[model samples]
Target: MVMNKALLAAVALATTMIIMMARPSVQESVYITNHLTKRVLIVHCRSTDTDLGAHAVAVGASFHWNFRENIFGGTFFWCKLAVEDKRIYFLAYDEYVETFGTWFVCDDGVYGTPASRPAFLKAAWTRP
Candidate 1:
């Protein structure tokens, strides 16, 4: 009986670990843009050694296309954070990208700024 219990416990533990590892991680960053409202919100996670950053970590994310009577457009997204540490947020319009281009962003704070790549950071928000 003792040996049976031990084996069962081990199996249960292994199953739990496998399930946990199989789950998709949270997004290291997220960006949202309202077509009708023309409002944009970018949330970036920390990539450095510090986790105190107020941004959301982009372990996973999604982007969707929105259409309305007056507005029709699609959002851009990074979805995944390469560094898996630092995240930055920004708010701007589509024209911001045309003006700045890819080299516009200098740091996390500059990521979504007027000079940043606005087209690449648009992401869809998932409802809880």
Candidate 2:
């Protein structure tokens, strides 16, 4: 009886570890292409809590890219999101701030970027 109980406890512990390892991980895929060098760099990020745009703007206020530490300015960028209780939508940036366009996921499974250009630092600050 003692040996049987010990074996059952060991089996349960093994099962739990297996379940944890098999869990899927959520990650962000980032890349940069340099036409001059004809090089493309890629990065994968995993965070339990997803950061939204308003959060990003606040973080951006004190943002500085630490390339020496392998952190990019873009990593500090958080999406300005328009979300409902059940769903979320991504907006794009232009030379100035314009609330137009929608974003979708690409075949690669990462969030798609807006077709418009990057929003200016100046314009983003003034907008409500």
Candidate 3:
């Protein structure tokens, strides 16, 4: 009876460990879209002092990044967008330790100003 109880306890512990290991870790994703009429948008994305490179998105196009495998420990990211001969910069910062999902939109011809900020969009509006 004692041996059976010991085996049961060991099985329970192993099962708990397996469950914990199988659980997925927290991750983050960002989506950027260009909603301009006749202008091309260039985007640069970076996090935690790492440069994730740049992209040129045409009107009505978009760019997306998933940080599931490469988790960023910081709570913020920096980005810049170029419109024609002008450039616009912005930063996405959150007080939360981990940002699950967020998105930005470059609408019309409003960006490329010194005081410009990317238009924050709801998760539902993330898709192009």
Sorted by TM-score (best first), the order is 3, 2, 1
- Give candidate 1 misplaced runs (Cα > 4 Å): 1-3, 30-128
Model 3: per-residue Cα lDDT at residue 59:
74
Superposed model 3: Cα runs more than 4 Å off: 1-24, 68-73, 93-104, 107-128
TM-score of each: 0.22, 0.23, 0.54
Residue-level lDDT of model 2, residues 27-104, one tens digit each, is: 323321111122121222222233322322121122112111112112222332221221222232221343222223
- Which lDDT tens digits does candidate 3 get at residues 16-93? 878766755656566676776677778897776568798988778777776543322235667776766666555643
Per the 3 Å backbone cut-off, how many clashing residue pairs does candidate 2 have? 2
Write down the RMSD of candidate 2 (Cα, Å): 14.9
**Which clashing pairs does model 3 show?**
none
Candidate 2 clash pair list: 53-79, 53-80
- The alpha-carbon lDDT assigned to residue 12 of candidate 3 equals 92
RMSD of 3: 9.9
Candidate 1: lDDT of 6?
80
Q: Rate the local accuracy (lDDT) of all candidates.
A: 0.32, 0.29, 0.58
Q: Candidate 1: what lDDT?
A: 0.32
